[model samples]
Target: MANQLSGLDQIFSALADPTRRAIVMRLCAGEASVGELADPFEMALPSFMKHIHVLETSGLVQSEKSGRVRTCRLSPDALVGAEDWFQQQRATWEARLDRFEAYVMKLKKEKEGAAAKRPSRASKRKGAK
Candidate 1:
């Protein structure tokens, strides 16, 4: 569990930078060479390479060199752990809410039952007379 948290932290950290996030978003469309990926950014190649390095280190992107050209592709499964965590949290929250709803309904029923059992005090006094 600790390791999973650490992995998620790393993933979040990698995505924290705008440049790195942009790279990931672009890769979603399709694979592209390093040059192609770098073209849109005004920053220097070395700085852009650092963003690529973060994505790679975080397991978000995979890169390979074919001869002189390096290509990058998105690894969709890299976010699986994060997805699983969110799903589990949602499920837990939903279950708790369902239970609370049930309890509220039960309380309402009990209150109605109590109200039904209670007679008017004036009717009781007239009966006593």
Candidate 2:
């Protein structure tokens, strides 16, 4: 559970910034260098680099220095935490729905059983015979 919480912390922290979220979305296309990642943004290199740094620290991106260029790649496992969280939410919803279904079925059966025990209008009228 601690690991899950930490993973959620990282996911939320990394996503808190719009710039970092945009970077993550862009990185979905493939790996990219810092310059390539920063090209679309109007911010300075230092500001943009901060976003990259956050992403790297969050384990959302992997970067390595090769000569003068630092290339960054998306880490697929970083999303596992978020996916697990979503799965847990889905399971809870499904269980709630299943419970609701059972309740409704029980109500339906009770209604039918009650009706079965009561005399119909036609049967009551036939008592004139």
Candidate 3:
């Protein structure tokens, strides 16, 4: 569990950068050579490669060298645990919000019922006069 959380931390950290995210998005269609992947950005190769390194370390990407070219591909399965964690959190929050809404509705109904049992202030004033 600790290891899984650590991986999640790394994945999230890698995704925190826009350049890394764009690289991941591009890889979604298929694998690409490092040069092709780095083409869209204006940064130096070393700087760009740092982003790639982060993604690789996070396990969200896999790269292999063929001849002189390093081709990278997305590792879709790496995100499964993170996605599950998000879904579980969404479910838990939705349930809590539903309960809160129900409680508010119940309070509203009770307030209306109590008001129905009580006389209006105008009527009380008239009776007193």
Candidate 4:
């Protein structure tokens, strides 16, 4: 359990940065060399490498050095934990909201039913008159 929490912490912490998130998004399409990945941003290669390092440490990405080129690809399995967590959260919230809606609707119907059972002052006056 501790290991799972630690892994989630690392994944969320690594993804907290915009640059790192963008890098992950780009990698989602397919693998690319470090140069290609860094091309879109105006930062220096070294600066960009810091983001890649974070991603690697988080297990979100895997890179291989071949010749002079370093290529990176998404580690889809790493995202499974995060995805599962999100799906569970979504399901819980959906169930809660559905119950809330039902409660609200029940209250509304009860209110309407009570209102219908009561006679208006005008009707009372007409009957008395």
Candidate 5:
């Protein structure tokens, strides 16, 4: 469990950067060489490489070198942990909100019931008069 949490931490930390996120997004389509991946950015190769390094370290991406070219591809499985965590959180919150809504409805109905059991001011005035 600790290992899973650690991995999720790394994945979220890596994705915190817009550049790294963009790189992962691009790789979602297909694998591309390092040069091709860096083409859309204005940063230098070394700077872009840092982003790639973070993604690689997070296991969100994998790269291989052949000859002079280095190709990078997204590791879809790496995202599963984060996705599962998010889904769990969504379910929890939805359940909590549902309970809260039910509680509010219960209170509203109880208030109505209490009001219905009480005599109205107009009826009391009519009796007095």
Candidate 6:
């Protein structure tokens, strides 16, 4: 569990940067050389490489070196852990909210029941008069 969380943290950290995210997005279509990936950005090659390094380290992107060209691709299962975590969190929150809604409904019903059993102010005033 801890290791999974550690990996998830790394993945999230890698994806935190817009540059890295964009790289991942581009890789989703298909693999591309590092040069091709960096072409759209204004930053220096070294700076762009740093983002690629993070993605590789996080296991989100896989790269191969063929001579001087490095091609990067998105790993199909890279986000599985994060997606599972999100699903579990969503289920837990939905359950809690459902319970809260039930409790509120109970309280509302009790309040209405009490109101039904009570005499109205108008009736009391009429009797007094």
Please provide TM-scores, in order, for all candidate models, with all chains considered together.
Answer: 0.71, 0.74, 0.91, 0.92, 0.90, 0.91
Candidate 3 achieves a global lDDT of: 0.96
Better of 5 and 6 by TM-score: 6
Q: Rank the candidates by TM-score, best first.
A: 4, 3, 6, 5, 2, 1
- What is each predicted model's overall lDDT from 0 to 1? 0.93, 0.91, 0.96, 0.95, 0.97, 0.94
Q: Is 1 or 4 the stronger prediction by lDDT?
A: 4
Model 6 misses residue 50 by how many Å?
Answer: 0.7
Over all chains combined, what TM-score does candidate 4 have?
A: 0.92
Tens-digit lDDT string for candidate 5 (1-129) = 999999999999999999999999999999999999999999999999999999999999999999999999999999999999999999999999999999999999999999999999999999999
Candidate 5: give the clashing pairs.
none
Badly placed stretches (over 4 Å) of model 3 are: 125-129
Q: RMSD for all candidates, in order, please.
A: 3.9, 3.2, 1.4, 1.4, 1.5, 1.4
Error of 5 at 29 (Å): 0.9
Arrange candidates by lDDT, descending: 5, 3, 4, 6, 1, 2
Q: Which of the predicted structures, 2 or 3, would earn the higher lDDT when compared with the native?
A: 3
State how far residue 67 of model 4 sits from its true place (Å).
1.9
List model 3 lDDT by residue over 1-129, tens digit each. 999999999999999999999999999999999999999999999998899999999999999999999999999999998998899999999999999999999999999999999999999999998
Lowest lDDT sum, 10 consecutive residues, model 2, at 3-12
- For residues 1-129, could you state the per-residue lDDT of candidate 6 as single tens digits? 999999999999998898888899899899999999999999999999889989999999999999999999999697999999999999999999999999999999999999999999999999999
User: In angstroms, how far off is 97's CA in candidate 6?
Assistant: 0.9
lDDT of 6: 0.94
State how far residue 123 of model 6 sits from its true place (Å).
1.5
Alpha-carbon shift of residue 118 in model 5 (angstroms): 3.0
Please name the candidate that would achieve the greatest lDDT relative to the true structure: 5
Question: Taking the candidates one at a time, how many backbone clashes does each contain?
Answer: 0, 0, 0, 0, 0, 0
